[model samples]
Target: MRSLRQTTARWLAAAFLAGAALAVQAADPAPIELAAGVYMVPGTGGEPDPANLGRTGNAGFIVGPRGVLAIDTGTSYRHGQALLAAIRGVTDQPVRLAIVTHTRQEFLFGAAAFREQKIPVAMHQAAADLMATRCDTCLKTLRSLLGEDAMQGSAMFTPDIVFTDPLALDAAALIGRPIQLLHYGHSSGPGDIAVYDPRTRTLFAGGLLEARRIPDVGDSDLPRWREALRNLQALPVEVIVPGHGPAGDKRLITQVERYLDQLTARARALVNAGAPLSEVADATAMPEFATWDQYETTHRRNAAIVYLRYEREQLVK
Candidate 1:
């Protein structure tokens, strides 16, 4: 097991280089109280976590008179604990519940820190199923990439609460914080759940909204994703928390919406033109986000996803 610091250092180096080359340096860790009871935990400049390295870990806290409601755990168990500790330092209130915004390995694995508290860790049914089946593989890959200890302890995480549609939790009751689970179809993951705190106007937007780096289109439905972004924009969101990147403003939602719109159009054009996969991959260019650090790698992957979707559509038709 590599020491956590070592892993951090290595990732930092990678992040620095990637950011510099792309001109997207890590933003400082700026913790902001977005809503009356919500706070945004930003990430410092450095290599991003292996799961979503380009974007910062957009974790947040929802505090009420009762206790704290953790939005999404950070990249590693260590990061999650740090986030947890940060919450504790601010308030002595117990952490009542943790709502995972999606199934991304980084966001879900941090549940270990609060395991002993027996807090109800909840995730969408699709997310829970993915974790149950592929967690071991994810753990092995993470250990190889981030070192064994870079993770919390175990990759096994089961959501105590699972629901298909929107579920509400009252923060005052300690039953859990009042959150609306909107599982938009194949947005970030198969089960992308967005947690909205009306009181805070803070939206924990899993992987749905990538602020800068080319939006990860993997497992994304281009049409639905574009629609989801528009829907998100319609919400009363002041502070936006992304799954992999820093806390953002409404601009994050706008950027993702544009990316989805343009990428789908470009990919569809290429497919209709009878372009090959390699041709489509090479021909596609991310719209006007080249300088947004970490765009190179993620852009390639995004284009690949677009190409794949186009091919899939052809087969279906």
Candidate 2:
């Protein structure tokens, strides 16, 4: 017969093991099938933290006849490993390529993992240049927020391919479906790009689009961003996989445009009124987007940035 203390210790050990298993499962939720061979691994929306392990941006993969093409990787080395595991769960095809969709920290660090597997990573040259300038600092900040354990083995890497102009994968031979990397200059960010898969009519709008979330405008050119949206609006996109929110339809493009318009208009008015920069955030309150994720923080920052830009233009004139 086992002693009472031994029985209690064994039960506690089993419970701890079970709890650890649950934590792993929570970090890696199942990938959502957006189309026949396209899958979206949804992010837990909002700011990155220890709870979400910095997976605040969505990642996805497209399975092709030749192999697989991965969309944005997650925020850390562990996050990238989890994404790769999710891809493996869905298909046996090797990942032939991984695209860092934009210049966001959440999507870049994970390239390290894919590169380790001997997969080539690609990004727009402009975005890569921007990343080289400041991403090390961003990585440190993320490590402080998400903890070292979550970020271990993560490091910055140079992209294998960088192109200035729009590049199209040989759809007929590579993926069995057309995939285009669309670049609209200096819009959402430097060299912001979107991936369009024609067969699925899916648009992977990197940092260029958001749904039910306040778009980050810290590095945006409002006018150029709007122009890019106009270009995207003409696409035959049936589905949109945004940077930070749930995947949706073409209406996501319109929603982003509306937000940008309203924000620019409000900020311009404030500048014209000679409202001080300190008052921009509070003065340009967006009640309609009050319920959106990061409205309080991101929206306020955006308002201030836009106000300053308009203020500068006025001074130049």
Candidate 3:
């Protein structure tokens, strides 16, 4: 009976290994048409793994009358190039502008590819400042997280133009429409921007909302992020191209808001209850959130950030 038990354990271990191997070999994101000429490539998995190479962030493009407007460049050179190929597969039109919504390494690193195409990159001024000042640290951390091979040939490039105010753009002109870059003020990150296209009624909300993934609070001001979501809730867009995962709708924004609210409310409760920052993750663990990707890896960090935020707010008061 002992020998049989040992054999059963070995079989289980082998099966688990097989499953992990299959998951590691998962495929890259494929572009899906969000609207008539608006296309978004939905990302797979969570976080940067050797398999996904941190391609978990969504990148999109719009076929405008004048030229194509590439949304985020993606995480690396090859990923950016693959997106370019996908853009070509749709239309042979020239790409005009690449607008970034955040200062995250994954999205900003791919700007080099667009620059090579002679297409200028643009970003919110706050994002430009953050990236410009922290480029070296971001690159070093990314190299560690994504592995050298995935980051190979990738370089961080700041936007050519930095805008402090909302810009009127015609990237959707190819489809005979106009799109605007809207900044709703400090959510998700300091310079989170949303690409709003009234034609198809789609909003490319970069890093502002990651449907199906835990909202990253690493660099976010929770209250500000919630406020941003509230602003998004008022938008009339039918479809939202999130920073991560598939293209979704207002429900995505709603869902993210709920999660943010819950995280804040729950974390605040724990902190008030005298729970240690280190223990808040377990104390506030939501069964409903158990199935979410990267929960185990990131939940504690989220709790810790909220705890620190609470501490800081008290100090300010």
Q: What is the C-alpha lDDT of each candidate?
A: 0.67, 0.82, 0.74
Q: Mind giving the per-residue lDDT tens digits that candidate 1 earns over 1-317? A: 96644543443344334334332443323345555567666554234455434224567777877788787775566666667777876778788888887766556667777665677787777877877887777666666776665664645767878766544444346624565556677766777878787765667787787656666777666778777887998898766766655555688888777767777788888888888788765677765877764576767777767877778878898
**Candidate 1 collision pairs:** 15-47, 26-45, 55-244, 55-245, 56-244, 56-245, 169-178
Off by over 4 Å in 3: 1-29, 145-147, 168-176
Q: Give the candidate order by descending TM-score.
A: 2, 3, 1
- Model 2: lDDT equals 0.82
Best by lDDT: 2
- Positional deviation of 86 in candidate 2, in angstroms? 1.0
Over 54-128, each residue of candidate 3 has an lDDT whose tens digit, in order, gives 776777888877678888887887777777888988898888788888877778787777788788888888889
Question: What does the lDDT read for residue 12 in candidate 1?
Answer: 38
lDDT of candidate 1 at residue 304, scale 0 to 100: 69
Residue 98 lDDT (model 1): 84
lDDT of 2 by residue, 56-109 (tens): 787888898888889888898888888899999999988888888899988999
How many residue pairs clash (N, CA or C atoms closer than 3 angstroms) in each of the candidate models, in the order given?
A: 7, 0, 3
TM-score result, candidate 3: 0.86
Q: What is candidate 2's CA lDDT for residue 317?
A: 90
Q: Give the candidates in order of lDDT, highest first.
A: 2, 3, 1
Which ranges in model 1 have alpha carbons more than 4 Å from their true place?
1-30, 44-56, 168-172, 175-179
The reply for model 2, stretches above 4 Å from the true place, is 1-26, 168-173
Q: Which structure is stronger by lDDT: 1 or 2?
A: 2
